[model samples]
Target: MDTSDYNNACFAGISSLFATLLAEESQSEDCLYLNVTTPTYRGSWEKLPVMVWIHGGAWVTGSGGGLYDPKHLVNQGDVVVVTINYRLGVFGFGWHQALNNTEGGTLKGNYAIRDMVQSLEWVRDNITEFGGDRDNVTIFGESAGGWSVCNLLAIPNAAGLFDKAIIQSGGCPAMTEAEAQNVMDGVVTDLQCTGTDAEIRSCLQGASVEDLQLAATGDAPAGVNLNMASVVDGQLLPDHPLEVIESGQHNAAEVILGTNDEEIPAPIFIGVNSSAAYDDILASVFPSPVDRESLRQHYDLWQYGSYSNATAHLQTDLYFRCQSRRLAGALTASQAQDVYLYEFNLPVSTVPTTHGLDLLYLFANPTPLLPLSYDLHRDMLERWTSFARNGRPSGQWWEPTWHPYQTGNHARYRLGNILGMEYPHDDTGCDILDSLPNYRYMGEPNDWFMTRVTPLIGLLDWVLDTIFPSE
Candidate 1:
């Protein structure tokens, strides 16, 4: 959270952002729950579409009960919205055999993901009582939650659980076993509990939350990075999502996905005051001197007013914009159905447009994030719920017709007033990003492979999980 907006002016320096920003999610590991927001319970006459929401806090922190409540979405859309609490950090994703100490069952690190799959199954079986159409389920989430939905789309167990999908501002990163094993090893070293597997398990089971937090966070470089992401375990996540999509192994779930205009900025740009500071950004994402100059001449970030504004373009494209466009192509490749894409550039009260801003308008919770006119709010509801209810977003005559994303058209509905057809965002810049080998984003785009590269990758991952069950 070294980014300036996160540490300082999150939500445009709102009183709520400054006053009550830091908070804890779970007090204990026993908590696995979900909240359902439904319109007045209707018997069987009208079955409403169900929208399952997964909150995102980098897979380390976050709860369904956050600033974005479901009352607004449920009331406005007349659909059932279920917000779930999946396991986070070590409790849900810890990949150590020592902890499983069970007599008959194996405990995998993806219990959090399993919790989500179970929740979807629950909704499918029981949501009808809550006035929901179990068959027309739409799974949507922002950030990590969005990333989770992307993984779920590829996972075999998650197949058929939902008919429609909405991924906002995130996509799955290709993961390997060695990478995950390295993280687990760091965690165990941090714990400093030396003994047999059983002994370590006993110690960890009895360890205090404060002590476990250290192991959960992992060590430098890899340790300091987001450690608790979903591992590509052969059983739970067989392959990288793009590989699954490109191979056409993925179910034909209609997708509506996109990223915000300005997503979270890179830490390198934080507190950057002058051209001297931006050189650091060029150093990291652009390694070669020639490539660095190309980027510098392309964007001309030195002209930006501050660190956040200057570094915004590269960071936004690196982490979100390009990643999303790459995923959209993978999702729709060689498929007959058109995938819907959108870009949330609507200028609002909260720092124009940034990551998670689109949610402020759609969420039920009241805060100082953004204020949308009721008319605009209604329009968004129509678009989202219409997609959930049917398969497309509907709009009034005033708004331009939002066409499905076609291979050639690259059609996108700019989610704003005076809507118009827009081309894909920064494909050339993304092509530059995809070209770099060391600066690989999402492990070199799985869609490029001819054979089953994901399974080959997953095989090594599975071996690590099996051999180092304790890790």
Candidate 2:
């Protein structure tokens, strides 16, 4: 029952960042606890399907508690829901040659991901005691959590811990050794450790959690601020997630994956006020002039009304939507598992269908400020729990039977005002994004955010405040 906060990195602003900040004062480094809820009405001898939730915060912030209520999924869906917490930021994802496996320490990175594997181990061993079917476990998460689920699939130790996965806005990518070392170099310089590897390891070990957190914060030596992501440590994670899946070594047999229609909010495009500004930003990200023109042609300014809006669409596709489709295709192509894809297009509020909005309905926690349809909540819960109960999300009760996302039709379910099937999803934009030589599924041009968006911080401050006014 020790649910004290895990010492996570400090973050600010609205959305999950606000919640992460509010818990900063009380967050404990000893926060690896999980909560399980099972239907009480179920027969005592019957074991319900289990669903494990991993919260998302770009791999830096977020926990598996609070706002993630599972009562509806437990009671109505007749399933067992478990939400677990893990270490984040530097304490969880820091990497240094001094702590490498070759140097006699564990992988020393991917600590957060390993923490998840451990939690799943606990579930596999003891979930049956809580009226959960250990063999029928499902791991589901959004954003970073979704990313974590994909990582778990690649880990040899995590194989067979879960049978199904639901990845919402999760992409398959991992930091290479060099990329991870870049982050570690920043930590070493920030900690002022000047010596041999052993001494540096000692110095890092002696540093306070607070100091490490500060060292990993923005403008730290890494130049890749908040670069807290899983690393391919050659042990726990042998290769990039997509590569592992493509090689037919992944563990997931059935999966449900998709992303929000608009993964990037307007506030993120603060500096792209004019078409010229947008073009400048594009020119910097895309190497070739022809590719930039093709990008512009694909996302026409006239169609989007404003440059900022156009930027939102382009980034959303590049980062979330189209990337998810690629992962879905990989899952199907590898072993041809039953993969169900979705797009949360419901405009539940004044804002566009931005990231993490589906959680409100998925968790059945509606807010008066942005009231969502109860029917939509029911639909989401049923679809998820049904998928957990069986490999398919389409139950006998469901109308217009949801089909698996095959490579041919690109069929996917649309969870919006009208919940039904959508066929042959158009992804002409992804073709353009794939053509970008600089872009890889794994984060490349590693200093991308620092080079492109860091300069826009001053301009985005007012926009963020306007959109999410402080209380």
Over 122-190, each residue of candidate 2 has an lDDT whose tens digit, in order, gives 999999898889999999999878988888888999988999999998776588889888877887897
lDDT of 1 by residue, 1-471 (tens): 221111111111011111133333324454566777776544346888899988876666667765556777777678888888777666666776565446664555677789899999999889988778889999999988998898888889988899888889887764565666566666677777669888777777777665566555432121223555677777788877767777888766888888887775433245545666566545644557877766666456545546446466766776777677777777778566668888886645345567887886678444445455555566777788889988888777786777888656567778754355698544666677666654443642222111111223345435644653433
What are the RMSDs of all candidates, in order? 10.1, 4.2
TM-score per candidate:
0.81, 0.89
Candidate 1 all-Cα RMSD: 10.1
Q: Which ten residues in a row are the worst by lDDT in model 2? A: 6-15
Q: Give me the candidate number with maximum TM-score.
A: 2
Tell me model 1's lDDT, rounded to 2 decimals.
Answer: 0.67
**Which segments of candidate 1 are over 4 A away from where they belong?**
1-26, 41-44, 97-106, 218-225, 265-270, 273-276, 285-294, 302-310, 365-369, 424-426, 437-471
Winner by lDDT: 2
Give model 1's TM-score versus the native structure.
Answer: 0.81
For residue 67, model 1's alpha carbon misses the true position, in angstroms, by: 2.6
